[model samples]
Target: MKKFVSLACVFTMAVSVLAGCGSAKTETKAETTGETVAESTAAAGGKLIMATEAGFAPYEYTEDGQTVIGVDVDIANEIAKAMGKELEIQNMTFDGALLAVQEGAVDFAAAGISVIPERQENMDFSIEYATSKQVIVVKKGADVITSPEDIKEGTAVGVQMGTTADFYCGDLGCDVKQYNKYAEAALELMNGKIACIVMDSLPAEQLVAANEELEILDAELFTDKYAIAVKKGNTELLDQINEVLQTLVDEGKVDEYTINHTTK
Candidate 1:
């Protein structure tokens, strides 16, 4: 299951963004060998595929249009290396990445995924390796949603589908527009299509810096811990990942990766 077959499933199901962006990659081990990615001549062991959406900055985002890179990539790569396997990344929509891991179409997902009770039912998660808060991004001086208390029934808001932001706004009775990419949602906000965007604080910072007209509203929405998602019942791989994550935390490499990817 962890052989060459792993690549075929992803290219067919969740690679719509590859023509312009990229994808994370993996394989699953059978009873004895426990191989979840294909063996490559390039690696003495094999490959571990990771699924991610390259739209969230500092956590996961592509600097060059062709290759995806960020804190998640760095952490996933280190996890792969520690297990003696090479890492391959696939970039797709956030929702697609979530489904891919649950389906075991890829080995795991490392897209700054939040560990929540709702998602825990479908997939297993590694230890919490990162943290982020939800924030509102609105046009500067637009008093539309200055505080979470300001959100009203049917207030138009934007969020990436299947993210915590989506859940937050929906629960609060916001009329939500769910986009596959935060960039898409941001465009709508600029065009006055949506009142604001609900996104992670790190990515909101990146978005605000890139667009002077947008500012993250002054209010705390939600704080979420980020973790890697593995196929449910895949304890072998989950155990391997948790070990690496613990080491990264002990060495402060997680923070180092975040700083390196974050724009000054």
Candidate 2:
């Protein structure tokens, strides 16, 4: 009888030990899962939707069967990651891009958007990531439009709508033809629909490199300061974006993108 009691007590102690170990494992697993959930939640706060034309090469354009990729795309991706969000780039017209950000239809617009006083009134802009001059692209050895001064009255100048080029050409007293995409305008220039294409210098170079017949004119029209734009008064998001952009600028990430992604 005493021996039976001793064995029963031993079995009870073994059972207790097993139960304690099982409880500990369960608690540990639960804790690990909870930590993973928290980390996931912190890493993702939905997608940060960005509006871009994706027609401006070296800034943003389609490649690899409609995959939007460029310098601005890369920069925007980094900014989104810094903010702990996924990036969703919405390709559209340049004018439409600005309107989308202005109307809060997207988080921000980052398609090499130039920061001008007019844009400043409608939307807040992040720090300038790039500076490019408005340049004239024309056929090789073109005699009529040799310089900025030659782009006077009656010159059929093509420009992307809502761009510094458009604004500058309008001021030039030339016949300004506005297109949604700079690529279209470039095509127009190639087909002789327009005398010249006024665009940012970097993208003009890209176009020139792709088409053997095209060349950028010697004169640069104006300087364009590229930046990301958010709706006015959205200070919180603007601040976050600026913080990330400054970090990138300080670390020379912007220059890296310009050097590597620039096709020309």
Candidate 3:
């Protein structure tokens, strides 16, 4: 009887040990799952994704190799830092950047984008950060286009696609040529493929500074306000961006940024 009782006690102890092992394994698995979820959330929540065309200098352009650095890049970095997130810049075409924001593929876009009614209909814009004018660029010593009025019918005009210049180039009664990069349009102008290039005054200045043979016409076609774009109905992000932009403006940082990045 004693032996039988001892065997029963051993059986009970063995069952308890097995149950303890099972419970430990389950707990470990649960802990690992919890950690994974937390890590995933942190990764997703701590990044600020921005889309931009890196060809627009003094705004966002490649520098020192493949790194994109410019006024807009600096401003976006500051905003992301203020939001306690890391900035991730995605280089894409100007149209693609806008589309990425519209499709929720990115948090925002800042590529010297001008605020216009058509863009406003698709995405919300932050407060204006900088004011820019659309100007005509032509080869120096070219007597064909002395002023904005010279862009008459059949004159070949080059402009970066998806810019305000592209939007208004048709009004000049010229055969508009569109390029993905402002630099490319500037090149086409240099090659005499286009009689003139229409672009924002800032980038036009940068281009002309690099290509001394190129010059900006004395008159500007029109002025536009530059702003950042967020997805439609994303008032939260819009507000955040505006807050940061206003801070930058109030502190005179925007002007400083322009001055620092602009070419003489």
Better-scoring candidate (TM-score), 1 or 2: 1
Single out the weakest 10-residue window by summed lDDT for candidate 3. 35-44
lDDT of 2 at 53: 91
- Name the regions of candidate 2 deviating beyond 4 angstroms: 1-45
lDDT of 3 at 46: 85
Q: Give the alpha-carbon lDDT of every model.
A: 0.85, 0.85, 0.86
Indicate which candidate wins on lDDT.
3
Candidate 3 off by > 4 Å: 1-44
Which run of 10 residues does model 1 get worst, by summed lDDT? 23-32
Tens digits of per-residue lDDT for model 2, 96-197: 999999999999998888888899999999888889988889977666588888888788999889988788778778899999976688778778889998
Cα lDDT for residue 174, model 3?
Answer: 77
Q: Summarize candidate 1's per-residue lDDT along 1-264 as a digit string, tens digits.
A: 675688887776666656334322222222224443323312433778999999989888876786988999999888787777778899999999999999999999988799989999999999998888888899877777788877767999999999988888898898989999888888899889999998899899998888888998878787988999999999978988998899999999999888888844
Error of 2 at 26 (Å): 34
The number of clashing residue pairs in each candidate reads 16, 0, 0
